[model samples]
Target: MTLYTFFGCLLTAYGPILSIFFLFIAKNAQHVLLTVASIAIQELFRWLYFLLMQRAEPGLNMVTKYPRSPFNRIIFAFVAGYGYALTTSLVSYVPILVESLGPGILMVPSFPAASTFFDAAVTTSFFSLLHMAWMVIAFDGFAAKKWVGSLKIGWVLASHLGASYSTLLNTSTIPFGCIYAMVIQIVFLLISVAIIVASLAKKR
Candidate 1:
């Protein structure tokens, strides 16, 4: 069962979301139980940024000579997310990814499907997208007059937690866990992208 799952994820990492790795990991999952700690700390900074942006909006009028663009929020969100994702990638995942280009294909003991370099790459691919997704959803919620305790924030945290722990599956099942991790991350991405598209069409 676990073996099939690992192969399924190996194909997925090399196939469906490979572009994501090129964009994010080449341009950022499971780091032990610390995945939990990392997600919490990362979201803490995002929430703090949201609060600061909220308070600064009133005084932002001082610099307004032209209309304040709604896209400004998105720009800031993406920038913050990109930086957060990049920083983590550089310090953690990039080390493993360095060997991705080599001819040698390293596998786990008794697990041929668990390619360490590529599995790490697959898991890393989801971080940048997830960061942007969570921020976009949370930021939009704030703009929509939604409370921090509302469904929007709830979804962000729930998805974040899900994606984080999904990698834990790898500890026991090897590559299957990484596959589970990406699937969860991709689900959150679709939801966030839909919300963003809707917001873009909405009248200010």
Candidate 2:
């Protein structure tokens, strides 16, 4: 059950990743097509990145190994991701209160009617939490062990930092204000390091 929760989080980013790319392209049939394409592209990159990481550090390869039951993993991953969406959506609503206090503080972009500030915020948060869970599950499946929440925290920090850098520096489609992104990155890095230390201690 816990393992499923972890996998759920990691694989849950599919919808958000696809939606981001879809926002870049023209809004037509191409949007749907691009969303599908983004999924394929992301999966390709994920596997490729895993392979590269495994080569660099064979020990980490356990994190990416598929579980005993592919169907179970899939169902659990989606359920975990979707379940997290509820929490994320609630967190996202807080921004609305922020907007009432002031504008441009967050600066959400205009996309599909459904992808507005409220929707995006919720979805983003959902994926973030889900990915965090995914990392823990992957660790259990691959590492065949569990520890204090520290390791998951560290992994999430590393993943968040990498994702933010790619989105902010490489891609020009930053959805949040500069200040907000910086703050989030800082928090993510700190939490991630803490997680890593905890996991390491457990290992020792």
lDDT top scorer: 1
**lDDT (C-alpha, whole model) for all candidates:** 0.59, 0.39
| TM-score against native, each model | 0.65, 0.29
C-alpha root-mean-square deviation, each candidate = 8.8, 16.1
Point out the worst 10-residue segment of candidate 1 by lDDT: 28-37
Write the residue-wise lDDT of candidate 1 on 1-204 in tens digits.
Answer: 244444554454334334443553333221122122333346667677677666765554345333377665664455455555645655666455545555566664324576765566566666656766677677767666646337777887888888788666655545455556667777877887887787767736
Q: Which stretches of candidate 2 lie over 4 Å from their true place?
A: 1-68, 94-154, 160-204
Per candidate, the number of residue pairs that clash is 1, 7
> How close to the true structure is residue 37 of candidate 1, measured as C-alpha lDDT?
30
The local distance difference test score of model 1 is: 0.59
